[model samples]
Target: MASINVDFSVGQGAISSRLYGAGLEHVGASVYGGFWTGPARPGDESRSAPPVHIGWREDVLTLARALRPGILRWPGGPFSQSYRWRDGVGPRGDRPLRFDHYWAKPEPNHVGTDEFLDLCRWIDAEPAITVNTRSARPEEAAAWVEYCNGSMLTSAGALRLANGQPNPWNARLWSVGSNNWDMGAPEAARRHNLFARAMRGVDPGIELTAIGGNPSNQSEWDKVVIGQTAEQFRHLGVWAFDGVASVEGDNPEDLFHAHVASAERILWTISNAAYRLDEMMLNGGAYVGVDGWGIWKQSRQGLQHDYDMSDALIAATVLHGLHRLAPRVGYAAWGNLVNALGLIQATERACWATPVYHIMKMFRDLHGTEATRCTVAGPAVAAPGGNSPVRSSRPPYKGMALIDASASRDVARGRYTLSVVNRSFSDRHDVEIDVKGLPTGIGATSHLLRAESPFAANSAKEPRAIEPFVFPIGQIPREYPFPAHSVTVLIWEETPGLT
Candidate 1:
């Protein structure tokens, strides 16, 4: 049996909602068949088409709106490194169809800066754009900031007005390129700092993010970047992913715990970086961005993943871990939004949410403002290694409990939410959540996400194959039985103490 102790009085900083962010890139069908429709044919030069008039799917937009993503990272993964922003802007008819060198696909260039910012407005999500510092010049990056957030009197702002938008989009977060190594040549950290300075000269209010290594692996690089260029940026980017494939004949349950350990390593890295930044006395508080993260064991030409029950459990645990590490992490985008390693799968006629999508929505909507400290006390299990996509840098194997849990508190709203991830394959653990230093709750609701088999996944025909089910539970019992390989979120009303 596993027991969770949640002490509301013992908490870290406020959990940032932006940690539950999503990203969009010009990869595979993510842009072509995922967001747009009505054919990729050349448009009539006479018609002067803006993206709003272009075939953006209402059904997909409806699904995107449901997640209520806090922020949307635009125009890349690798695409940002070579993305030519000027080519994608202005008249849609004049925009050229260029070859995306990164993904080796023909980019239609229909969705540009304005279209992406417009989509953000429609969904009410903050725009987090990554500037090109590899193929493009620093001037181009500055011009992009001006076009998005500059005043109407400026030259780029006039072009934006001429293009159609009268007001500035006012995007806040600007990522100054990604990891780039020139085949054993010079790295791009210094170039990244130069671009950051130029972009800031354009809009001093925008938050700049610099590309760096994961918290644990890059000791020297982290020290140099934070010590040298820490004044130029406010956040550092960290990318992480895992595969559920069997390693040394390990089972799916072992893979699930390994993912948890990997996420914990990411948190540790972020905390270490934050401490380093503080010691240097940087101009601003530097946080971390887990910008690219996912669990993909399967891939196709477009990197499609049929997320299974085990993936859903991993997603829940990862989000739970992020909530606990709120003091150092301010943003996270779930690698992608559609087509390639996405939460929702798209086709010509229909779009459906995956098991990962349901779990993401559950945590995003149910999470609160503050993280409540939780400790899991139970018999430990040895977690196997080799879950990460990168070799030779797998998370260290440690004794982990079968139950992993995190809790959040909304003091203003008088609500507390607790999420538990059960990684055991066979044994059912009786989880007793002891609430201390808090008033008793009057009502409670428990939502459970589980599948008959760990490998069960959802298809278009069976979209709800692995979805969450809600049930009203009895009085906060001494202990509750949590089945093997399941995730449960319990929401209850707490009586607020007198101020």
Candidate 2:
């Protein structure tokens, strides 16, 4: 039998809701076709913010509201390299059409700055904008910031008013370019400082992020960039991926290992940088932001993924890892939210939730203000396969623990959420969950994320093929059965003064 222990007194760090955020890039059908399925009624003159002229798919909006990603990044991943803020704004008909250099497609610039912010509001998410550090100037970035956040007296803010928005969006989170391209650390720092100084000069309260480069040369890049511009940046931004083209076969077990390996690599990257931040930014807040992260299966359509139950388990593993490394990891956003690597797949008339969507949505309730300690001791399985990364080497984990778990406590409400992952290929494990220093037996239940086959996925036709099964219960059990390759979340009801 597997044994799991959760100690409520042993607090890990506070968890930020942004850690469960998802990003939207202007790649493939993610934006134009998937997110902004145009033609809702024109902008409402009465409302403070509206999707002017352009329309949205009601089905997508309804589903997105339920998913409720805490943060949503806009504009680009690499597409931001060449994206011009000026062209995306103004009248919908007049906005110039630009060729998306990264995706090599024509972008109509319909869902520009204003529309994206409004979309975020509809879905109840905080908006995060990216600046074009490589292709655009510092002044241009400052202007974009001013347009979104500055007072009505400012020129950019005045332009925003003329464009239909009555008040400022006041977007707080901003990140500079990742992957310095041709420029080395020194040059990247200089450019970042220029942008930071200009942007911060406009709004002193805004939080700024600087790129920590890719894994291949991350350490040296961190030294140079952090060494030079430590005072200017609020967080170091990084991206992680574990899927490769070769792993796109029929091996469900291999896919499970590859994704778990990806989770390990992500935590490793955060831990590696946390060490430096501790030494460097001692006086200030220390946190890292994973703005874009997901599996990078080398599909014909760039980073698009046909997500399945296996992918859902991997998503839970990654989220659990983030919970374990709280406060250190400030934020994380799943790569693409709509189409072409999306959690919810959409068509013109209808939309449906994917298996990954169920996991992400279910995991939302598991995270609270504080993280608690949870450890698992059990038999191990040999993880023979490896995943090829976009920048770094394979994961260092040789074998895997049969049971992996993490816990979070809402100190204010006296409620606790615990998650356990059973990574076995075939057999189920009956586990002992020992709770300490907290009262259980108060209203509690378990929700399991599992399917008959790891390869099972949700599509437009069978949207509910693989969904969370909520077990009827009165009190939480000490020993529970965890199915093979599944994630189980157990939540306790709110208790007064439990903290």
Candidate 3:
């Protein structure tokens, strides 16, 4: 019998502000065809009609609000550096036509700055714009910020007014580039650096994020870029940092593990430089390969490969990493909101939330206001490469029990929630939580999400593949079999006298 003990007395710290927000870049149909089609005409109900009203989708807005996302990235990943603000502004008819370097599609400029701002308003999310840095100039970057955030009295402000948005937008969160290091082309870093300098001159208060290298060379890039850029902005007295991480994988399990390891590596790199983790975005969660255009596919084969039984476990791993390293990590965002690795998938006719979405919602709803310290003491599960210890260890946890736990306390409510993910595929582990020293009592409500098959998913036709169940904790007794491939959220409330 494999058993584990958890002590909730040792508290970690407060939850990170970054945990509150997510990102939606201009990739796939995420922005254009995905979320931003205008509302249908008075009588037309066609699926092709714009799914989002005023270039925003209601389903996407609803999901974003549920997460209480603090900030949303806009306009581009690689596309941002090549994007021209003028093309995305002004009347849609008059807006210039351009090519989206990333998705290989004609840039319609339909969801311009004003429209994005409107979408943000609808969802109640803060707008974080990424300016064109590769081929753009400092003056261009500064002027764009002025156009959006500056007062109406300025020239750029006048241009914004002429474009039908009377007042300056007052956008605060901004970035210089996206993966400027990976294009492997000439003048990439130089263009990004120039944009950074000019953006500071526009509005000193705006938060600026500089692009770092790829995940493979993250540490090396951090050492070089942060070392140099820190000096450039030292005189201007602005906040400067790097943007790292990308979304690509087959299933939630593998993707989740990669995200956990990547985050740790990036955090370590940024910490060594004493630089702030300003705008670190996680990999894509919604994208599936369609005609080999994106990393994942839309077929069941692709879905099973990328998002099956591993998704819930992966999500647990991510939450645990963020909670444990709350002090260093800030501003973590998922790839998109609607389609292409998003939480919600919407067609003009209908909408549905993914299993990952439910997991995220559960985390948002139950995880308390602050992180608490908790550790697992149980039989060691062997690593895949055998129990023999070797130099340069990479695996964070050893063994097969696959136990991950996060504890949080709500000071005002006098409640604590423990979220645990058991990764064992065949055997069930018996968990014993030692709550003797906890300030609160032991009664708890447990919510479990599990499936018989690892490759299960919720489709438009069949929408109930994955769901949660709630039951009294004590009813199950000491030997609770946490079914194979499952996520469990245990809510413990205090008994008035026991405390």
TM-score of each: 0.90, 0.92, 0.77
lDDT of 3 at 52: 51
Give per-residue CA lDDT, model 2, range 176-220, as digits (tens).
Answer: 775564688899899999999999999998888888866667788
What local distance difference test score does each model get? 0.76, 0.78, 0.59
User: Clashing pairs in model 2?
Assistant: 40-55
lDDT, candidate 3, 1-499, per-residue tens: 5443545555676774445444566666666655776654655444345345554666666766676555566774666778888777888888887887566778778778888887777667777787877677789889999999887788899889888888778898677666666664234445656776787777887766655554245556654555455433221111111111222334434423432332233334333323332322122111100001011223221121123445555656566666775554445555556666566666655566666667767776777777876776555443321111111223433334367777887766666778877776555677765543456335778888877764477766765678678888653356556776688888776642222
Give the higher-lDDT candidate: 1 or 3: 1
As for candidate 1, its clashing pairs are none
Q: Which of 1 and 3 is ahead in TM-score? A: 1
Displacement of residue 488 (Cα, Å) in model 2 is 0.7
Kindly list the per-residue Cα lDDT of model 1 for residues 1-499, writing each as its tens digit.
Answer: 6788988777677888788788898888887777776433466334432232346777677878888777889886688888889888998899988998889989878889998888888876788999888888999999999999998899999999999998999999989887554411124678877898899998899998877665334566666676667778888777766654545566666656665455555455556656666666545488887767776554577464787777777778778778766877879888778868888887766678888888888888776789988888887777777643333445455776678888887878777788988877667788777877465546667889988876788877887788889898846688988888888998776652211
For model 2, the superposed segments whose C-alpha errors exceed 4 Å read: 40-54, 244-255, 387-396, 495-499
Candidate of highest lDDT = 2
Q: Model 3: runs farther than 4 Å from truth?
A: 1-10, 46-52, 164-168, 182-193, 231-306, 379-401, 413-415, 436-438, 471-481, 493-499
